[model samples]
Target: DKRIVDWTNAQNEWKRREIVLKYIASKGDEHELYALILDNRFVHHHRSVTQVRMDLNIAERTFNRMQEKALWEAARIIPANVLVEK
Candidate 1:
């Protein structure tokens, strides 16, 4: 059905890209990098943002900035779909 197809498409789009996201995160600072994958399904570790923040012992504002940077970096670096013709 439509829901199944949509879910499959969503999963497909994120799955491969998540691998690249981890690679990108690994290229940065250790704690800073955690913002990219913590509590993410692709990483297989589930924790709330506050829990992660507490684990990291960082202030909420700092965590917010880190999360924003991680997200935007992921957004900026992840490639958009392009049709390739052979």
Candidate 2:
């Protein structure tokens, strides 16, 4: 029972993350924004900010600002009720 509960929690967390990623990827400047979020290490393991900036050819300050904005948007986009186990 305990192990099942733990596994369920982990699975739910992974699902929640996937939902958020999909939501972000679907809405607005999808390609650029998603790439910015992914490349700048918003959700998954990613390249360092410096490397991402170089790869994306974005300014450091702009990248930082976008990363912040992306996080804020992701927080707002994520459903509050999704975490509640059904």
Candidate 3:
């Protein structure tokens, strides 16, 4: 059970990185991308941030910040008209 838990956690982290990559390639927002990454079942398999950076060729903090920025921009780009007036 311990191994399974560890494996699952690691896998989730890897998936998070993968999701971030996909979102970046697609020009997705940073904030939304991060939120998406943090969502359950996505974090990544790697335990150390350094390992992630080396493997993914990106600094973990940088990736996180970018994702956050992208999400913020995405929200701003949304059309207000799309929202129904109260």
Give candidate 3's error at residue 82 in angstroms. Answer: 33
Compared to the true structure, candidate 1 yields what TM-score?
Answer: 0.61
Error of 1 at 25 (Å): 2.4
What's the distance in Å from true for residue 30, model 1? 3.8
Prediction RMSDs, each to the true structure? 6.4, 4.7, 11.3
Best by TM-score: 2
Residues 45-83, candidate 3: write the lDDT tens digits: 424445444544657788666546654543454345322
lDDT of 1 by residue, 3-60 (tens): 9999998787667566666667567585345534443522446667777777778788
Candidate 2 lDDT tens digits, 1-86: 99999899878876787777776777767445754565358446566888777877889998888778776676676677553434
State each model's CA lDDT, in order. 0.62, 0.69, 0.49
Candidate 3, residue 38: Cα displacement in angstroms equals 18
Worst 10 residues of 1 by lDDT: 35-44
* lDDT assessment of candidate 3: 0.49
lDDT measured at residue 46 in model 3 versus the true structure, 0 to 100: 24
After superposing all C-alphas onto the true structure, candidate 2 shows an RMSD in angstroms of 4.7
Ranking by TM-score: 2, 1, 3
